[model samples]
Target: MSLEAQYLANKLAKGFVGTNQIESNSRLCMASAGTGYKLSLGADGPPGSYRDFEKADVFFVIGSNTADCHPILFLRMMDRVKAGAKLIVVDPRRTATAEKADLYLQIKPGTDLALLNGLLHLLHENGHTDPDFIAAHTEGWEAMPGFLAEYPPATVAEITGIPEAGIREAASLIGRAGEWMSLWTMGLNQSTHGTWNTNALVNLHLATGAICRSGSGPFSLTGQPNAMGGREMGYMGPGLPGQRSVLVDEERAFVEELWELPPDTLRKDGVGQGAVEMFQKMADGAIKACWIICTNPVASVANRGTVIEGLEAADFVVTQDVFAETETNTYADVVLPGAMWTETEGVLINSERNLTLASPATDPPGEALADWQIIARVACAMGYEKGFSYESAEDVFEEIKRAWNPKTGWDLRGVTYERLRAGSVQWPAAREEGPDRNPIRYVDRDGELSFPRASGRAVFYARPHIPAAEMPDDDFPFVLNTGRLQHQWHTLTKTGKVARLNKLNPGPFVELHPQDARELGIVDGDAVEVASRRGRAVLPAVVTDRVRPGCCFAPFHWNDLFGDCLSINAVTSDAVDPVSFQPELKVCAVGLAKVSSPRRPCPSPSSRLRSSTCTDH
Candidate 1:
């Protein structure tokens, strides 16, 4: 299904006369990490594997609440901790994951790059960096030290709100560890300067020579199951199949030849519009049509007013989804019922590069078809019969195998459907016969480092800290940080409907520090109006010390389906990182005020506090 989607996207680019509008939901989540990896490490995938969790001497977790968001992997890290590995967590909130950390730095929101640079400076000052490794395996290293010096501990402490001692402690822990793996997620990626944040995090590993080894590297935790799979298939506007970019001439030629198309079939002048730009263009009437698949952009996209305007302005809109009641469906000119996961078979790649074949367990309820079938049928209808003539999902997978270019080091030729049926396999499976799966990238069998860049070495970026596009001021005095809860997923598509999960997380509520709650004359369970420059949402306030005094936290799960004016994304900033074009969904400025009257009263304070724990600072 993923392959067919890419195939259709490529075909559309060929048939259409303008820039390709194809973009993935990953643009909102992991595009910054992807751009950062490619710029620094010559690739998009993480260099480390889950096995690193068990063998690492230290776990440096930042911007991720692993206990709630990635419980299974968190369990492995905790298991390693029990065997005497130190754990360090850094975030704006003192989350459930931070409770188990040897050290937790409650840094201010959107200060990750500063905090990271400060740590690197402290590491260098403490003589922890490996100069030999820097000289041998990395380029552009000479430019970093001078830039890093600007972010000394005292200055970074003022910027990040972490005590100077806390900054020194984190630096000491990371510097002293023989092997440490850094893990992060949307907290670092969902920012206006998200790409730099990722680069700074990677710089630590490079400086310490803590990467391309058994138990050390920078690993990005993915928010979705098959987001990596989608990247592999090149579903984004700037990508071709097999992780090849449209901007590269050789890569474009390889894909064109494999697809049996003429020269210059793919666009190479410049990259296409990204997710944010795609919708903005739609609203401006530059783009006339859109085909949305398996995503609820109305509730999920930041600055959703613009997204709704885009949908409303488009000449035609097609929504392919399993559920008919998604917020996006309201804007669709045509609603194509697509089979759900259990009713369709496909391959799903996870953060660790493992490919698992998902087999159907049940049939579709009505006239629903698999997503690939729907796309293929549409392609045939549009007179692209030869390119999209796939009889089964296996046929599409076989074509995807032919499209895999081994030079990208993501070789998928050996990842056949039959092999996948037997068991899950990791990629870079270049050969038909041996265990071609490599856990770590950039390192060959002889333990020699070989990056895929033209220089055959990784690049060091001297990125300085940049504040979030929108910062809190007197008018909007609180930074609104959005995230997921343990019991709910994005927009609560399926999880919200489940009885037990609903019981686990009753409804949407805002987390406010007790001091801020008191200052605003709001109490736990009191109705509070959280207003941003763009929009506003009214929810119960949970006066918890989990959040910083000047920062508020809310789960971005609730929408109109739950209740009136419940979508938190309506209040998120659409400001995008210049490099990755990913929106800063994590941090935005907002003001809070108590509501004197409420249409629907909130649940008891105890019920609301059950999901999120609180403590007095």
Candidate 2:
């Protein structure tokens, strides 16, 4: 048996059974806050209610690729296309999602803040702001117009490469849409300015009163199926289970009381370093140890070469994953084989805040252990026996739910393990008797809508448009954007093992506009050297007009198996967004050159000819 499975089996042998079995439907009825239940009144009954290709009056796609990455969701958008819904794709490149958009606003990389500011300006100028909503439930109203006044459509158009009319139209569409929803993924969050980007989008929705209702609100599409659960379980840095930050003294005290830890043992107000900062600290020898679970930092982090150095520099590095051959595991001092998602009974929270249970379909292979079991054991090893003495995944989940439910208005007593196992429930399932929990939130009992902030008011932030930390200049003329391909998953720990999936896009290739390719003396199937101030990578070039001029895109999934090539992140800059500390993976300046050596021969001529047939540019 793999080490991880063996660990799980041992835990089960020690009398760990599933905790609080609740039906799936019951779980869906609960809310994250555990108080003041949510209600579903319209078409947005449940997260699964909408599918890909479904017609939306106005489709605002920010940082995500609905097609290649989320094909199922993408199909729903296609449904909308057939129904004549206007699709507006905002991305750094002509992604598959962008290609299908009715209007593709190919903005300059990492300039989302500027683009959003311009949209806000247009909305205010055209008198599209919701006056009643703003007066009733928002702060910072007076200072907003002054902040937006500096970002005229023409200024935004100059920086983002979007036409003035296009900017105006996009703003007008969003402002006037009867039902609108905004979808964003890694494109917005995986940047130095990720937080700012998120807040900017939220600012617009708040300005026009477009959130917490059917076909409305700002949705942050998580990358992993269980990333939401991870956040719920306090797996994120400096967070307690149930959306509680560790910085709050009351929250910290509550958690410490639950765990019975001494005041000094638990962190007080320190925020854990973000991904990039963590690695940089490790590289600098500040952080002595790291335990990586379910993620491959070496292949996924920007400037991957630096990530390797950080791992190498760590005094101890532990990698727990289902596969033994991940790029991260190769560098680990100890490789703990972990159970695959299919081999474990757990829960995953989706983008819509719906919690779904994943039952184990098969027994684990070898000694592979479940993630929770490993964590428990580690906790025990650290001498927190009582706190970590959970017998099952259910028990751990119960503790998490309890932590989330505070009696002082944040009660989630209705959602027990028994209820969750029976059915999926939206959060805020405080009153079991409350009118069939909200499908749409922030709407009061009297049907009056509002924001969810402390004062029941949305705060409008005056965010300025800042240029990408790294810009194209004489040294690096091409802007590089990194993202996913249709077939490959993040870091390729599991997806890489599937031969059929690997066949889709076999290796790393820089997608460039035909004009730029010609200018650089590059052709289809030609190897190219892409360099930046941070690092450099060599990959095959697929010259095509599918991409816009002066910008290039590369998928982040390739590694040695794809041809010993460095990951695209090798050259990505480590600059972070000021607010969220997210690395700026969306935009960086790079210089590309044709590889002259025949040592790496181009793909067959037929391959080049076949690739040329699909150009829409």
Candidate 3:
């Protein structure tokens, strides 16, 4: 068994099973970026801060709707743009962020690797690389040229469907800039080539010597709140607390000693099962029962058919959440009502590595309780009272402060709610020293431009581009893309409760160009059945130029609760990137068949018509 499977087995032996049962929704989101960051930098977490955007000379944002999703970060990026910094947006949609971009490349989806490598090829071919920095601070770059040689400007232009001039413009902006910052989100992370997409971006920064300076580095925007903190706390399978990996003997020893556990108490191997692998195990009945928390994978993860099958096959399932009703709740044998963020007191770590303390605005209602309280109770019930007897959130934070890896400069000693009440504090804070006012990390290690890699040099990965796992074909004639809505959040457990937010976007709809709709004998407001090899969904159509002629867009917020057979994930493919194990949520091949107009505005799930029939409403 892998270390991840053994870890779960150990937990099951202790009568404790959490995300080890399946996986969090992050598997559908940031898993790829996390994998790429770790492999490239020898660690996860950003090497730059949010403040770098202000000092950046050129900014490139790909696969992110920052203006809508991370509005505050977008506002911060806008500050630099107004101050004369050039902005480049890479996306398929003409989003609010893209509209203001100095250069917008609506490149074909899933072709990020080619576009990025194309940038590198231009940088080297045009004498834009910094040789002194490359020689002194990096390694393994010789292999890059041969690998990237295939991605010449013309070839990249052909593959990306972007003009050759636009490619050069974006390439020149990045190559020529002294201080460049690249930001991306789910667009790059939610693809079959997500890891390579990330490494390819990092390769650009390394080739141009654009990283570890005052205003430059690759920064991946966090879509989920406190995702950085979650990683630091060892929320994933392979990692230990404080950026330590389970496979490292010294790290394992460090954690065991701190926790006062016996020798060899922790797993020595780092072979942890990723989210997709865990679900596959569930479907195979390798895992008998499962426990899930804080996420709704049914509506978020790709290949909902497999996810539903895995859940149905489980011997027992427990789910903990703020809402009593959710798609996952339908499969749960036990539901634990835990307090939401508004009712929890804890510290949230932002993309900038700033720790903001969250104090509960009000107490929990009815039988609901804080998540930590539920967890602490579970530990006591399972006979781990001594280790889990945390009376307050501060107690938990203090433990992490002492337990975090000191070698990685991840000290959290002085951070406390009392001190954080004034404002946010960036990390690498000391126990004796006051809060760190600095936001930058690895800006200049050891008072010099250095890195934490083994050779004190960055490794340039010579990545090759691969097509998306699923491509549009004759049977599945259109590309179906799934993503977030400006008004709705993941699975809509909280946002669905807001009347105003729902008014902004009430139901699921697919965006198709008027040309494609006309050819398919479909129009705006007509029911359409989108069928992939994996699953199918029925959605109303909205004719617009927002999407490419051959592509369709669907927001994933609508769960089964919406009544009509609408779930973009249902029609999504489970084929994941081998490197990151993050599924291809952004690209799936689907054939469109117009459904007959229902007698009453879209009836129950069972009443949905076949995709072949179409009629006037």
Give the candidate number with the greatest TM-score. 1
Candidate number with the higher lDDT (2 or 3): 3
Structure candidate 3, residue pairs in collision:
none
On TM-score, who's better, 1 or 2? 1
What lDDT would candidate 1 get against the real structure?
A: 0.78
CA lDDT of each prediction against the hidden true structure: 0.78, 0.60, 0.71
Task: Rank candidates by TM-score, best first.
Answer: 1, 3, 2
Candidate 3 residue spans exceeding 4 A from truth: 1-22, 268-272, 443-446, 570-617
Q: What is residue 576's positional error in candidate 1, in angstroms?
A: 5.8
Q: What is the TM-score of each candidate against the true structure?
A: 0.92, 0.83, 0.90
lDDT of 1 by residue, 117-195 (tens): 9999999999999999999999988888899889999999999989999999889988999999999988888777777
Write model 3 residue lDDT over 158-202, tens digit each, in one string: 998999999999988988787999999888887767877888898
Candidate 1 clash figure, as a count: 0
State the lDDT at 266 in candidate 1.
73
Each prediction's total of clashing residue pairs, residues at least 3 apart in sequence or on different chains, is 0, 71, 0
Worst 10 residues of 3 by lDDT: 1-10
- Which candidate leads the pack in lDDT? 1
